[model samples]
Target: MNTFSRRRFLQAAGAAGALALGAAACGGDSGSGSGTGGASALTWWDHQLQLQPAKKRIFEKFAKAPGGMPVDYTFNNPEKLGQALQLAKQSNQLPDVHSNAGLQVPAPQLINEGWMAPLELSSEAVANLKDVLLDGIHIFDGKVYSFPIFDYHVYTNVTWFNTKVAEQAGLDPSAPPTTYDTFRAAARAVQSKGGGAAPWTWNIGMTERTADQLNYLAQAAGFEGNTGMLFKNGEFAYHDDAYVDSLDFLLSLKKDKLMMAGSESWVDTDARGRWSAGAACYYFDGPWCPGVVLSAAPQFAESLGVAPILTPSGGAVRTYHGPQSGDYWLTPKSKHAEAANKLLSDYFTTPDYSVEVANTMSQPPRDLDAVEKSTAHAEYKKLIGWFRDTVFLAPTPVVKNVAITKVQVETKPVEPNLGTIIQGAFTGDVPDVKAALKKLSDDSSAERERAIKAAQAKGAEVSLDDYAFPDWKPGADYTLDQYK
Candidate 1:
């Protein structure tokens, strides 16, 4: 199946019934109630509505809020949230409070289009937020428009290994490779075991996943750090030497048959299934793997080992980290903006609520301290520690120029989907690494130029200089301060 279609299918499966039933049956209105002396009808939509117990607890808590608003809570998967929102927009009945569905559309775009309302945190809420959330995650253009609820602590580029596979292959599962050359050696050892196991498996058929894998390899090579998209000195740097080297390294693995057979056709679930089944010794995924794998193959729990992606000798062990998940936001058309914000602030910033979110989601909460003191799960705490010690934030540059922002956010001057080009190289369809990279670079540069012109036509003040950050270095923190 096409990876895109497969993802769509999975998302649609969760939402089809609710969508068909329309807003009425999907908790459209929880009826009117006045316990705390406020208009008691506010709609809240979240992706986790399918979890009945959690849903009930959340509703119960909201019902007890100071204002005591009756929340018409609706559930839809993140993948379908955007679509649902669009439908709601058409009907002029958008939810007062909702998650960004993983920011499917960039926050800036949503704000600029007047779809999302800017947030106003009280002094107390601000202090609470500062004490818990990481700095610079929710702010945009000097205003907060979103709030962090749940975050994946472990960077997304982690490599998970089956200890049994490593032991069978005569490798030390205790000391997983931390360098590329050593990693290759380990791969060779795993392959030499000859029990139908492969060194690595990934959702190679998916453009986004394949691109992320390439980016991880690039991170190991010490070119770009964790920000998966290529942005160097304020411009797309996808066609650079480091990127080519990364592709060449991946190509080497493909040529050597280190990747599981038929992996190029595998979707995310297929790859995950193979990894859980021990068909592959190595898999790359986020922090959620332990819970997922343990649930699927409970007996194999003791055999699982997780580690950061190996860096090249002398390279920084950096990978993309931070809140790459859904976030809560207030809608522009919300009549209960103050009430919605109050509920959200209380839910996200309050320690008990934050801890509950962390425990239930098996992810870290916005409150890092809450995570430390959490009685949620031992495994989650360990994962949080690993994440804190190992990962660094890769900040996305905020260009002052609207044109530049349009290009970077809305228009997306460069497409990260190089899977076909990469697959061609693996299959000997495109053999020259330098030539392929040059073509990619040239195409991206041209698209960027086109975006600039388009932005200029719309009265944007943008230039190449707007995209330049010459002082920025690879493997170092890129923060909002850097933009200043």
Candidate 2:
């Protein structure tokens, strides 16, 4: 049985529930007492991604404000926080400041319900957020809402190849493939050796893995729009031809037997193991794999190589140019907004604290001064340098009903069912591409209509267009004739 729907949907459900709890934990209203009257205690809630760094900043560095009261912190994962906060809301254990990845599972609901305090980064802080670092995380309605942890992503995908395998295949390891054709050619050459494992290994089970696979192919083929958000010209277009073609290309890869055997069964750990065992010539994944590599096969680090995904169109998709991983800290209608901001400013901007935080988590510092001051600079140089020079930080998509996005990401109905329609087409369980595409187009249309109606009820206007997938010449990104 396919685990795709189950895994993705379960995540969405958990996330939705988590956000609900986050909202409840920090009640919609500021309570009866002002934190300033006495020794104010601030509670900080954040995800575990940057735990050590956060702990170092708050516990060791900023616990006491000059002569003021210290912070009281509780750490939890975003998932646990959701559940815990809901209970806390009832018991009045809500935190003063919460840090979480902006635009993640809990943020949408929190934003919709007005459970979060609006963050106005002072001019000094805003000026520090220049193009040198990634921006656009703490934004809603074109105003800042939270302070982002870091400006560069640690999860950007890299194209990695095995030198020995490439050399044995009589291919230049340094001049690796730069297009789908070349990439496939390299994989085939490596596979022909008949001695090692599969030629290519990649993330197959994760949602982002699926999305990234589709993104690499679609962008290489020249699709110039967001796959997740089929919105354009103030409307959502799920029936776009490029969207269809993206699915088709992914299905073609599976059908061609070009991917690793049992790829669909492989998760990150399994895939990483395959790469570390010298089982594949190429591994397409994020840079965080270095840690896995170190643990799995330390020697693999020396042999490791990294490069951006090749585009058939010779244009970069700018994956490295976006916001880095980690959460943004938000104040939830705190009685201590001023105190909270001061702590946040010191926590995020101070060189000693910022460098300490960035170094601890291997995250690129958001403050240029902090980044420049660090002696452990080489650790995050690649992640920061590429993002600084090439990435374009854009605003997160305004998902009107995050529940729908969650549902869409997670589960699909069986056969004639609506949710699993896209997966069916890719898996060849659906016999006709045209019919499957048509049904998908129809389902998306219905979803858009429902979304528009819902938005209208909330006193907002929305229009949606169908997402389309178009045909294109092999190796061409996108062309006029590709669309009808």
Candidate 3:
């Protein structure tokens, strides 16, 4: 593996300019919810069914309860949920219950825009949530806006290697590579032993998924805190040395021939299928990857081995184990807020329902005890162990400049897609990484200033100060208190 210093990266980029100020804008939802088809039918929407079967039995039980409101669930892909919600909010036809996609829009923004309803959990329900979920994620400002069911102790940075392939390549599955150099060596080894197989495969074609994987690698390559558009002292640190080094590392993978050919055309599902079919030696993903493999090739399930994402020697082994609120929330337009709340309360508060969701989804439940007692497949236990061993509960803070949120809400810009930029570098479409990053930095800063002004005009408390994290040291533990 190749290495570059932060000093060198910054020296190559030259100096950044000052930020420009602008104004904020506000909007309102004009539609109202239509009641359920039946007297107590409650409409629900989520993306979980894309991967697993809906809990029809559980829903049936809830519907059978005395004065129970039957749930009319509509399962859509999580990727499409944000867009669907935007359309629903426009016509005032939001569902009674919905899942929030954190990446598309921050949960706090939804609450600020009055798209989400405030949840009022019972004392016991609150305690259960407090024990299982990360408190910092659910509560925005000072109030709770969402309740998360799945807790990703480990994010999408893990390397899932084929143990059989490793053994065939004279590599030890027990001691997988934990550094870029060793990982590259192992990849080369697998390549040498290949029978029409590639050493590694990834979803390089999908910009969002590509960005996700690259961000994790960026963290490993000394891009200390945030993955994309680093901010510090109220300035966008887009051309930072660490960021440039990350892009350089990604380019090195392509130059070294470690990445599989045709990766640039592989979406996540295609890559996952190829990995499961043993067409590649390595797949980078989260714990949920095994479920995909098991579904596609059950016999190869036992051949898989999991490892924490590799970092440079002597670098901090920090994982992106922050609380992602893939939570269910009551929409503001819902006519049956009380019924929706009761349904969610019953679903999560019940031990069986919680365990069922976790087991079926092959994820770690908020209720730790429920996980311990779950009758899930043994592979799930291994995944849970991976989470416990590698996940960093707290690390350096990645302060979100409120401007980014405001920009996302108002206009979805194509420039922030770092994946496309990285892909361009690999394809030789972007010859100068520094120049691209500099341009991105300037554009993002301008957008941030505009958002700040717009938000201020609308009486929103957003400023450069809100995005500043002055005392944050790289690799230091950042508890919830630091955020406050």
How high is the CA lDDT of each candidate model? 0.58, 0.47, 0.60
Task: Give the better candidate number (2 or 3) by TM-score.
Answer: 3
- TM agreement with the true structure for every prediction: 0.72, 0.61, 0.77
* Clash pairs (backbone) in predicted model 1: 234-467
For model 3, the superposed segments whose C-alpha errors exceed 4 Å read: 1-41, 49-54, 69-72, 84-94, 111-114, 131-143, 229-235, 314-316, 349-354, 357-363, 367-372, 375-386, 393-414, 474-476
State how far residue 151 of model 1 sits from its true place (Å): 6.7
- Over 277-333, each residue of candidate 2 has an lDDT whose tens digit, in order, gives 777777766544543354335576556655555555455544322233224445465
Candidate 1 residue-wise lDDT, 227-271, digit = tens:
334545655566666678777766677778888888776655677
Ranking 1 against 2 by TM-score, winner:
1
| Candidate 2: worst-modelled 10 consecutive residues by lDDT | 21-30
Per-residue lDDT tens digits of candidate 3, residues 290-319?
655665566886787877777766354655
Q: Give the range where candidate 3 is weakest over 10 consecutive residues by summed lDDT.
A: 17-26
The best candidate in terms of lDDT: 3
